[model samples]
Target: MLIAQVTDPHIKAEGRLAYRTVDTAANLARCVNHLLGLKRRPDCVLMTGDLTDFGRVEEYRLLRRLLAPLDVPTYVVPGNHDEREGFRRAFSDHGYLPREGDIRYAIDDYPLRMIALDTTVPGEPGGIMSDERLEWLDAKLRERPDTPTLLFMHHPPIVTGIEHMDVQNCANASAFGDLLERHRQVFQILCGHVHRPIQTLWRGVSVAIAPSASHYVALDLDPNPRREFYLEPPSVYLHYWNEGSLVTHLSFVGSFEGPYPFFDEQGNLID
Candidate 1:
């Protein structure tokens, strides 16, 4: 299976720039078109969140319009910037809220089961999974004990080594990790919200955080409040799962001027 993940577009109503900064919607559209133009199309496109900058009804409407060109199953979850009801009404038909009482869904599509979990906490920047949602996850895992499952969400369940973002991450990460520890079938966990591409391992499964389709969060190895990313070129992650192994690749859009390197099959230098 092939999946393209776009995160944290932070789209605005007027197609305006965010914080006098990035033109998120335009960047997102570029990434989408890049995916659409791929010779080997992805099976589906998964959006990890921050679909809108302020989570307004009009924002969602505009977002829906902007995303209409893609011809594949597009699944989305809410980020800190999203309103559950507003997001639902604009995109899905499941009563404008997650049918599972939480923004969680299971897509049963071959060798791997895709589970999208809602990590948005209303009025709060951080996220948490309630006891009820945890129970549901446990039950769902039990139902398909032997199936390989790939979990998706907005917040990374592990710390990203950045101070500010670390505080706003999933609060119940330990509990969530415990649940995954108990389920051997859960093979991968994919998330967003950090605005950078990151990878880690939690509970014996591969955990990946997709980069934003809009602005990037500067990768400062040191922890500092003054740190943030510039409006660098937007990017997306393409995940390929064959049999039970998962491989992820990053794709950047637009013109990039770099060193020219030409390689020969069995010869000397060609650059």
Candidate 2:
């Protein structure tokens, strides 16, 4: 089984730029086209979040149209940029997103028991997983203790060296980590929000952050007063599950050079 994780398109209504510069919608459309053209389509697309810029109704509507080309099953969770009510309203037919609560749910399809965690706190940039939400997660994990699970959320558990982004990281990370300690079945924790690709050992489990299709957060180590983003190459993660373990590969978006085979006519190396 293979899964693709795309994050943080930050789309705005129609022609508006995401931050008055980046063409987020166009970037997202390109990514969707790339996914559709892949030799092996991802069994599912785990859209981590920031589906819109201001969580506006129009923005979500535009997003649905931009994402219309994706034929694979998609599971979405929210980021700080997303509003719960608006997200629920737009994605109500997903059948898994709750009609009136934090958007948390699980996908039991394929071999992996995929879990989506709601970490976005409506009016804040930082994330907080409430006690009620944590309890729900505990129950879900307990119900399928032996199944290989992949947990998806918008906020990352570890603090990347970027100080500005770290300040807005999950506020209840310690509590969240403590909960994951008991569920060894959780093989991976996939997330978005940093707007860049990152990976680390979090709470004794593997954790990965998919790069945004819009713009990338600059990889600055020093603490800047404001966050900075750049037009770095965007990418998505293709996670392949073989046997019992999962392996993830990063695919840069947009067209590049070529596949150019190196072998000659008789399978000999070409100089």
Candidate 3:
């Protein structure tokens, strides 16, 4: 099975730009088209978080339109920029999304058990995994200890060395990490919110962060305090699972030159 992960689209109001700079809607449109045109389409699209710029109703409406071409199953979580009320209203019909309470839920649709975790703290840039949430997750992991489960959230539990971004990361990450240590069935943790594709090990499990559909966070790991992002080539993570193993690939979006063949009819060197 193949799963496509799209993150941080940050779509805004009609004709509006994100953060007064990036044309996020246009960027997401290109990404959507790329996913649609893929030679091997993804079984489902897992949008980690930050689906809109300000969690506005209008923005969510625009997002739905942008993702309309995709006929596969879709699952989403909320980031700091997303408002729970607005997201629920916008994506109410999404069966996985709960109409009330925390948006933490589970899906057993395919071979891999999926969990959409809500780590967003309302009205705050930083995220927190409350005690209730922690217990909920612990219970879920215990239920199907043998099933390979994938957890999705907005704020990553691990640090990325980007000081500014790290401040807004998951607050109770250490506790969350401890939980992972006990649950060997949790194969991977998927995250967003940094606007870049970052991979790291958290508590002995693999944590993969998907790149944004709009721009990338500047790859600066220095001590000088500053925040930056760039319009580098956009991309998403495509995960393939088979025989109890999962492999991920970075699929770059945007048009490209021909994928010319190299071998001749006789399977010999072309030149």
Candidate 4:
């Protein structure tokens, strides 16, 4: 099964640009087109978070229009930039999303069970896994202990070397780590808050952060680095589940060089 992970699109309202510079809408359109153009299309799309820049109704409306091109099932969780109420209202038609409360749910239809965790803290940049949310997650993990599971959320619980982004990572991650240690079925945690592609191991589970579809947070590791972003090449993470394991690939969006063969038609090395 192929699952395309697209995160932090940060779509804005019509005629608006994110941070007064990035054309998030156009970037996302290109991303959607890239996904559709993949030779082996994704079975589902997991939009980790930051679906909109301001989480406003108009932003959500435009986000929907941009993502409408994707025919596969797309699941989303709220990010720090997303307003829960606005997000709920925007995707109310999606039956998988709960009508009220935090945006959290589980999908068992695929070979790999997907558990989406809501780590967003209202009015705050950082995220947390409250006791209630932890308990709910524990219960969900227990329900399918034998299934290989993947947790998708907006905030990464690990600290990246980038100090600015690390400060806004998942708070109370120690407890969350303990919870995951108990659930051996969870093989991976997919996230998207850092705006850069990163991967690490926490609590014995592989955690990957997909890069933004627009601007990427600058990769500065200084003690007092300023919060900055760059108009880098947008990309997505394609997780392919095969032979009972998940292999992820970073697929950059936009046109590039040709797929030249390494060998000639006669199966000889090309000079």
Candidate 5:
């Protein structure tokens, strides 16, 4: 199965631009088009978080419209920027999402089981793995111990060198890691809040953070780095499950010269 992961579109309403610069809606539209134009279309799309800039109803409405072009099933979790109640209301049609409380659920329709975690704090920029949320995940993992499972959330549990981003990363990461020690079925954790593509191993499980489709957090590793973003080349993460393992590919958005033959018409290597 092929899964397309698009994160942090940060859609704004009334034709507004994110950070007074990036045209998030347009970028997301292009990203959506990119996904549709992929040679091997994904079976589903996982939108990790930050679907809107302010989590307002209008923003969610616009976000829904922007994502309407994607024909494949799409799943989403809330990020710090997303208001829980508004987010739930926006995606009410998605029956997988609960009507109240944390927006967490499990999907078993495909070969790879997926469990979505809600890490958003009500009015904060940081994330947390509270006892309630962790308990829910533990119970879900227990139900299918042998099945290969994928966990999708907004905040990554690992600490990247970017100090600013790290501070707002998922809190109680060690506790979460300890939880993973028991659930061997969880092969991967897909996340998005960092606004940059990152991969690492936590508790023997693979964790991948997909870059934003709108803007990217600048790659700064200083102890007191500036909290800034750039309109980088937008992209999406394509996860392909092949032969018992999942492989992820970073597919950049926008048009570029390509398909040039590397070999001559006679099939000889071009010199």
Candidate 6:
């Protein structure tokens, strides 16, 4: 199955740029348009979180309009910047996610099972999975014991080696990792929020995090308290699963504008 993943759009109600610098909403729209222009569209689009810069009704209205051209299904979960009530009210009718508190469901088609978890802790920059969510996940995993599952959440369950981000990561991630260790059917875990393409292994399975369409977290591994991001090319992830293997490709939107060198036709000459 083909799944297009978009994360941390951070659209504003006023449709303004983030931090007075990055035009997040416009960047997201450009990314979406590029995805639509693809020759082979994905079966569905999965937006991990931070759908809005602030949880405003007007922002979601704009988001819905921006999402109008998607012929395929679009699914979303709340991030730290998202208000659950606002998201539920705005996207309730879409039928992509369960019409209830903080989405949780499994896609019954194709040999794969996709589970969306709510890890957003309200009014905070971090995340946590409540007991109810944990119970639900355990039961759901048991119910589909044989199906290879792909778990999606906004906060990644493992550290990304970036100290500042690591502090604000999932609070109950260790427990979640233990849960994954017990459930062998889980094939991969996908997430957002680091604002960069990060890959690591947890619970014997691979976990891949996609970069934000607006800006990227600066690649720094310093132990300092303060951290920052960089203005890199906006990107998305295309996850392809077939048979028993899964591969993900990171794609950046727009053409390259840089210098290049070419070798001579003789194949022995320098650039």
Which predicted model would earn the best lDDT? 4
Clashing pairs in 6: 11-53
How do the residues 70-125 of candidate 2 rate in per-residue lDDT, one tens digit apiece?
98899998888888899888987798787777788889877899999989887898
Report how far off residue 18 is in candidate 3 (Å). 1.2
The whole-model lDDT of each prediction reads 0.84, 0.89, 0.90, 0.94, 0.93, 0.85
Error of 3 at 226 (Å): 2.2
Per-residue lDDT of 36-141 in model 1, one digit per residue for the tens?
Answer: 9988899988888899989998788878878989888888888999988888778765342364456778888655788888888889989987777789889889
Q: Kindly give the stretch of ten consecutive residues in candidate 3 with the minimal lDDT sum.
A: 219-228
Candidate 2 residues lying further than 4 Å off, grouped into runs, are none
lDDT of 1: 0.84
Per-residue accuracy of model 3 over 1-271 as CA lDDT, tens digit each: 9999999999999999877899998999999999988889999999888899899899999999998988889998999889999998888889888889888899998989999999998989888887889999999988899999999999999889888999999998888888889999998999998888889877878999988888898988886647888999889999999899889899889878988879889998899
lDDT of 4 by residue, 47-155 (tens): 9999998889999999999999899999999999999999999999899999889999999999899999999988999999988999999999989899999999999
For each candidate, give its TM-score against the true structure: 0.92, 0.97, 0.97, 0.98, 0.99, 0.92
Q: Could you tell me how far off, in angstroms, the CA of residue 217 lies in candidate 6 after the best superposition?
A: 1.5
In the predicted model 2, the residue pairs found to clash are none
- Cα lDDT of model 5 by residue, 30-122, tens digit: 999999988899999999999999999999999999889899999999999999999999999998999888999999999999999999998
Candidate 5: which stretches are off by over 4 Å?
none
Every model: Cα RMSD to truth: 2.5, 1.1, 1.2, 0.9, 0.7, 2.9
Q: Model 1 misses residue 159 by how many Å?
A: 0.8
What's the true lDDT of residue 96 in model 1? Answer: 27
Decide which is better by TM-score, 2 or 5.
Answer: 5
TM value for model 5: 0.99
Q: On a 0 to 100 scale, what is the lDDT of residue 108 in model 6? A: 73
Q: Is candidate 3 or candidate 4 better by lDDT?
A: 4
